[model samples]
Target: MKRALSLLGYSIVGLTSVALGGCGQSGDAAPEATEVPKDFASSGPSAKAVESQFGTPVKDRVATIGLLNKRNNLTQDLVMKTGESRRVGNVIIKLANCERTLPWENPPEVGAFVQVFVEERASVQEKLAWHKVFSGWLFKDSPSLNTVEHPVYDVWVKDCAMKFPGEEEDPAAYASSSSAAKASGKASTAPAVAPAPSASPSAAPSPAPAAVPAE
Candidate 1:
């Protein structure tokens, strides 16, 4: 009986040691789960909608131009002519966060196009939602870009007023065959642009062609 009791005590101690060892191992084990960060990308659909209207991604990144301090307009300026400010004007835009590559014409099979995208404040997501309501009014009267936003003209300032209707002009849709892309070769890296005419005030104005094609 004495020998049997001693053996039972030993067995209990051994079992206790094994249990403690397991607890220690479990406490020291590495974590079993991990989290990955979300990837940042340019806005995709908004960018695509704009790309469909405009021939290419004109600017490397989305840009924002403030409206005339006086008129406070939010319009898109996507033209690519010299003396034309490459940044465009008078609107604020936060770039979309995803990018996708689609087939584009080298010689530009489409007619004149306007790069279209929603404009939003740099700090807010909901700003773009409100922007859609008034975006249609970007163009109404032709106000000189300088006269509209100059600090000196602040006396004419107004809030929440839309002064222009978005009357866009598309000439590329009807232009001649010269604008088609090359059928079988590498795509051209060169931009589709025309020579800038000298900005001489005294240059005799040519008669306005009735049906001008878009560049």
Candidate 2:
């Protein structure tokens, strides 16, 4: 009986030592940061493309996008503009440009060119790796046009908060133009004036012609 007990103790000690060694090896090698998508590094549009499309980049302009962390049931807005990128958790999102039709135009549409990178592990024990999961335009009104196909995340365009060339007018210029239009409208709407009374001499000549005919 004592011999069997001694053997069991030795087996427990060996298992403990193996567990400790594995822990030490894992601690020595830390996980690395996720890398950017290859497409973003290669084919992402440059600043010149922005200028060509938008005339000039509006530094203050921004596009707001909704990022859904389905794993956590959380949502956040990522505001960016042309040639801007944002990193959140295990995902990286970049905005190339955003567009919206004019208020007067029909079939209104709003869309944004977006790229998404997700960090994932090929297996449960492997380190996290990043890959481009989705890269294309997403629409605000029609999200079905394009989609992010990740099981853990979903991204959609919320709004593009940028001004177009003629979206707004200078305060002074607008006031002046408004006043001039009002003046023109008022003049066109003015009432007519009555004619002055006829002279007494014209009345006397009319009576004299009638008396001569009677005589």
Candidate 3:
């Protein structure tokens, strides 16, 4: 009976040790689960919705676009020329071309072709990498025409830097023109002042005529 009791005590101690060891191993091996995200891409800009129109050639040739970060609601403006790119956080934006319609054209519009590259992980097993997520023309007036299909970022057109006739002139030019107009108006309204003609001596001629008549 004494031997049997000793054996039972030894068994209980061994089982408790094993249980503690298993719990430690489990804590070390498992991790918090992360939910995989779904793709956020959408088809945008039907052919009929965004018509590409270009009249005046691009002058300065620099394109400007607005970028939005959905996670934090932050927005930034990106300026680039054709074949130029700007990087932010893990995203890259490249410009191809920007265009605008002539002033006379109906329903004025502005558009730009953009390419977006993003750094993302394809899956849990893969490492973070860069990928071209979206590339298309985006319109300033109509943003729904094209969309950047990523979980973190959104891009849209603002306006093309090119200029057209009958459009608003440069601020410097406008100011100069205004100043000149004001000067012209003042000149036209103000009356001209002239010096009066001086009267010359006729006394010598009158004296000669009086002497001749007396002789």
Top candidate on TM-score is 2
Candidate number with greatest lDDT: 2
Model with the higher lDDT, candidate 2 or 3 = 2
Candidate 2 on 72-161: residue-level lDDT in tens?
899999888766767776798878887776544556777888888777897899998877788888998898989999999999998877
Decreasing TM-score order of the candidates: 2, 3, 1
**C-alpha root-mean-square deviation, each candidate:** 24.8, 7.8, 13.5
Q: Write the per-residue lDDT of candidate 1 for residues 162-196, one digit (tens) a residue.
A: 11112134333333334454422224433222222
What C-alpha lDDT, on a 0 to 100 scale, does residue 20 get in candidate 1? 90
In model 2, residue pairs whose N, Cα or C atoms come closer than 3 Å (at least 3 residues apart or on different chains), thus clashing, are: none
Ten residues in a row with the worst lDDT in model 2?
A: 191-200
lDDT of 3 by residue, 39-107 (tens): 312222222223234434433467788899989999999887655666677777767678876655557
Give lDDT: candidate 3, residue 201: 53
Q: After superposition, how far is residue 98 of candidate 3 from its true place, in Å?
A: 0.4
TM-score of each: 0.17, 0.54, 0.51
123 in model 2: Cα distance from truth in Å?
A: 4.3
